[model samples]
Target: MADTFAAALDDFTRRDWQTLAPDAVDDPVRVAVVGLGWFAREWALPGIDRSAYTEAAVVCGVDPEVTAAVAAERDLVGVAPDELRSGAVAEEYDAVYVATPNATHLEYVEAAAEQGKAVLCEKPVEATLDRAERLVSACDDAGVPLMVGYRMQTDPAVRRLKESVADGALGDVVHVHATMSQTMLGELGTDHDQWRLDPDLSGGCALMDIGVYPLNTTRFVLEADPVAVFGTTRSEHAAFAGVDEHASYRLTFADGVEAMCSVSQTAQHASRLEVTGTEGRAVLDPAFYEREDREFALERGGSRVGVEFEQVHQPAEEFAYFGHQLLAEEPFYPDGEHALGDARALDAVYESAETGSVVRLDG
Candidate 1:
């Protein structure tokens, strides 16, 4: 049995994976990063700097002085959001990375599209489905590549899991269990006036913020969209009154795979994804958080085998993948259409929670 597991794992490693681009291009993709929030300041800018295929060329934000200061420190040009929206500095970068709030993605994306620059928009696409559709249409009409930042798709462990499931090493995946949670107020120093708590800004609460990880990652692993969802949500915290502080949703896929997922903003910080199949089960502990070390293991017939891989800076990996695909002139997966589906699924989950009934997608 151990030998059988080894062979299956060997097959998993043999599949082609995304890697550094060859020394083919002379220049890296110059990226203009909009939004100087914590993610952009901490992860996205540093990630772009680390990526061999990409570099940060400009910073744009609502506050011109703050944006310019950030750009000065990084030795990059800083421009007001208006300049980006109007394509005033379009010559400085080849692509744009939209890291702004959830509700304001379309304007930056459309601005980039009009300038014929590729866009890598952060997840959830936009705050609403109609806006998401318009965001996609903007890129579609411009005929430029639009990639959603589903960085897990580029993680080594996640890639291996996808391979295992796709190759039937899991023998018809039967069910999935996923959890992602974090103490939002604690993380923000007990600040209750943040945009995440506002439904208009964040689209929802815990479900929209962290729940998308499990939902989208499961869809990536199974290669199928959820056809239906049943959900329940709660908001006990005063800060979370406008949005859910806790949410649990069950997703039903077309292939009979059912995923039970839970997310929260006022819970302990942790993430886990588990998949069960007829032959064996695979688990990815610390799956969603990019900062932690990811551990992957497969168990069957009272035996378990662990797979090993080096942890990577996820944002860097994601940015490199986007740059490589852009330079190669290939279509990037998790494109606008993919994100739109997630937007729909997210809405369905919220609808189910409110209506106290299962919500059917695409109906």
Candidate 2:
């Protein structure tokens, strides 16, 4: 047992969750990453490099020339999407990482599932609820494991917060407040034809893109899904004409826990998640962004305890978790069903925004 709250938090942050698995494979799981986007190259590759249980065996993408170039640069197998879909290089890897756009996730997932490859798909699963369900079904039908990439769930600070909530230290969560935003056009340098602005390709703009972190991470911490949602959206820029540039939503959990969340595509960099309970409150400043260092604090009665943890790579931890589970034959926490629940909540948010009324979700 820990003598102090800070020690307890430190222990939680340092303990390796992967070792808790009953068993592990003798070798690293080879992964064929299906997407040559900036995220796949910049973040995912680095994660694969650092993860103890995974390796980048192949690089695939929609664009053949770009994929080949990346693979050659990294000395990895270069495969086109069509080749992967046709199982021409199925023997090259044991799993597939789908980092494609929202609407195109199903195809890559289906191909991987058909080849009996475990899948690690990015958040929201797909562009719409229907497509998301199909992606889950495809993996289910193929008997291949599927995990959604919710990197925050694996963050040390977030994990410590979850432990605090579960141990009743927080005395039953009552409300959560979360916010995440970044300047989209500033990052892109131009927003003439951003795929994120396309409703069909990327789903809703700001809400579906970055808003998901707060909503999904809150659910992970609370271990409960929202029962209903009330949301509103705005589009002030011409680039955001087809989708929202700003979004705010309220989620009401069945256990009476309420969460207020907001996200934007045109704002100064900011990210935070604060949870309040009957006895105490916990806050994670600089929460949604992976690059920023995190600071966690807990307040109870009249005193507060602040803790700091060494910054760990969020994407690397996420990849290591996925590979660990796959190697151990252990079921993933945020599996297909978990993603489905998130998809339902995201759809409800958009629905409420459109109807100008609260939307109730099916239990």
TM-score of each: 0.96, 0.95
lDDT of 1 at 200: 96
Question: CA lDDT, every prediction?
Answer: 0.88, 0.88
lDDT of prediction 1: 0.88
After superposing candidate 1 on the true structure, give the runs of residues whose Cα lies further than 4 Å from its correct spot: 1-22, 188-190
lDDT of 1 by residue, 185-241 (tens): 887565887788889988998888899999999999999999999999998878788
| lDDT score, candidate 2, position 24 | 45
